[model samples]
Target: MRPELEPGHVAVVTGGARGIGLAVVEALGARGVGVLCVDHPDADTSAFVAACEAAGVAHAVASLDVRDRDAVRAGVATAADLGPVAYAVNCAGVDGLHPASGMTADEWRRVVQVDLDGVMFACQAEHDLLAGRGGSIVNIASMSGHVVNRGVTHAAYSAAKAGVIHLGRSLAVEWAPLGIRVNSVSPGYTMTAMTATNPPEVNAGFAAQTPMGRLAEVEEVAEPVVFLLGRRASFVTGTDLLVDGGFTAW
Candidate 1:
C-alpha cells in the first residue's frame, strides 16, 4: 500500500457495477487500495473483483440501493469488513429527461429520490466509516446542476444535482472540524453507458455546444473523482470539481 494509504485502508464506491462508477473502482483498485464495490443487488460483481485482484488489490462486493436508508447504512458496515473505509464516492444515480411542464409526479420524485436523496443517504452512512480515521468524500454530480441542456429535458435532474452540489458543500463545512473533507465532481456530458441511450443526433448536438467539442470519456471523469478522494486533494473541500468539457463555460 502507498504511504498515504495504510494496509487496511479501503474505498467504498457506489454504483460500482458499471459506467463511471465502475471506472472509479478500477482506478482506486489499481493503486492497491482496498475497495468495497456496492451496486444493485443483482449486479455482476465478479468481474469487478477480478479486475481489482489483477491489480494486486483487495476487493469486496455488496448489494445495495442508495435509495434505501437501511441498506445504505448497512452497506457501509459491510464494507468496513475489508478495512477502514477512508475514502468514499457517491456515484450511484439514474439518468432521464423530462420537461417540467409535462413531467409526471412519479418521474420527478424518482429522479430526485435517486440522484439527490441517495447522495444524502450515502453521505450519512459513510460518516461513521470516517469517524476515527478521517477521510474524503466525492459525490458525482452533473453539469445539469449548473446549466440546462439544449435538447434533453433535465429539469428534474438539474434540480436534484443542484441539491447534491449544495449538500456536499454544507457537509464539507460541517465535517471539516473532524478532519473529514467532502466535495462534489460535476461532469458535463460524459460518454458512458448512462448516456448511451440517447439518440445519436442528440449526442452530436451536445458535442456542438461543449467548448471541447466532444463529450467526456468515463475515464476522464473518473480520474478527477479519484483525485478528489486521494491525499492529493487533502485541502480541497466544499467545492465542485467540474469535469465538463467546458459545457458551462459559455
Candidate 2:
C-alpha cells in the first residue's frame, strides 16, 4: 500500500453497498484507510459493515443519492469527519437497456441522471473537500462507453458512461493545479449481484464477446480503481483505465 493510502486517511465511495463499489471499499479498508460507504437510501449495508469490521478500519455508512448535489456534498463532509479524505470512488450508476428509437424520454433521463449526472455531482463535492489537501478520485465507467455492446440496445447507458469517462479527463485538467487528480475506470462485462440475475445464456454471450472468454470479477475492476486512487498513479491523471479484459481492444 502506498503512504498516500495509509491509516489516518479516509475515502468516500459511492454505491459502496455492493458490486464493484463494495470491492473498492474492502480494498481501501485493507490498506488501513478509513472509509465512508455511500449508497442509496434503501441499499443494504450489511456487507459493507462486515468488510470494514473485518479490516478493522474506521467506517461510516451514508444513505445518499448521488443524483442530489446537496446530498452528495453532505456525504463528503461526513467522510471528512472520519479523517483526512484522501480518496473517493464514484461508483453510483444505473443502466437502462432500451432501443433508441422506442426509448421514452423518461427512461433516457433516468439512466443519464444516475450514471453521468450522479458522477458529476459526486466529483464536484469531492473536489471541494480535497481542493488544497490533494487527493485522487476514480469514477466508475464502462467498456460500453468505448464500444457498443454486440447484442445490447442501451444507447442511453452507453452515452452516459462515455460522458463519465470524458468528465474525468476534463476535471483532471481543471483540478490538477489544485492538487487533485481525477481518473476513470471502464470495466467490461462483469459478474455482479445485478448481472447474476441474468440468464445463463445472456452471461455466456457476454463472455463469448470478450477475448478473455469470461466476465470480470468485481475485484478485477476494483484493483485498478484503488491503484488510481493511490500515489502509485501519481502522474496518471486525465485518462481512463480500461479494465475490460481486452473487450474494447477487439
lDDT of each: 0.86, 0.91
Tens-place lDDT per residue, model 1, 57-113, is 778877887789898888777877887778999898997677789999999889999
Task: Give lDDT for model 2.
Answer: 0.91
**What TM-score does model 1 achieve against the real structure?**
0.95
Candidate 2 residue runs with Cα over 4 Å from true position: 1-4
Query: Who wins the TM-score comparison?
Result: 2
Q: Model 1 misses residue 144 by how many Å? A: 0.6
- Per-candidate TM-scores read 0.95, 0.97
Model 1 spans > 4 angstroms off:
1-8
Q: Cα deviation in Å at residue 124, candidate 2? A: 0.6
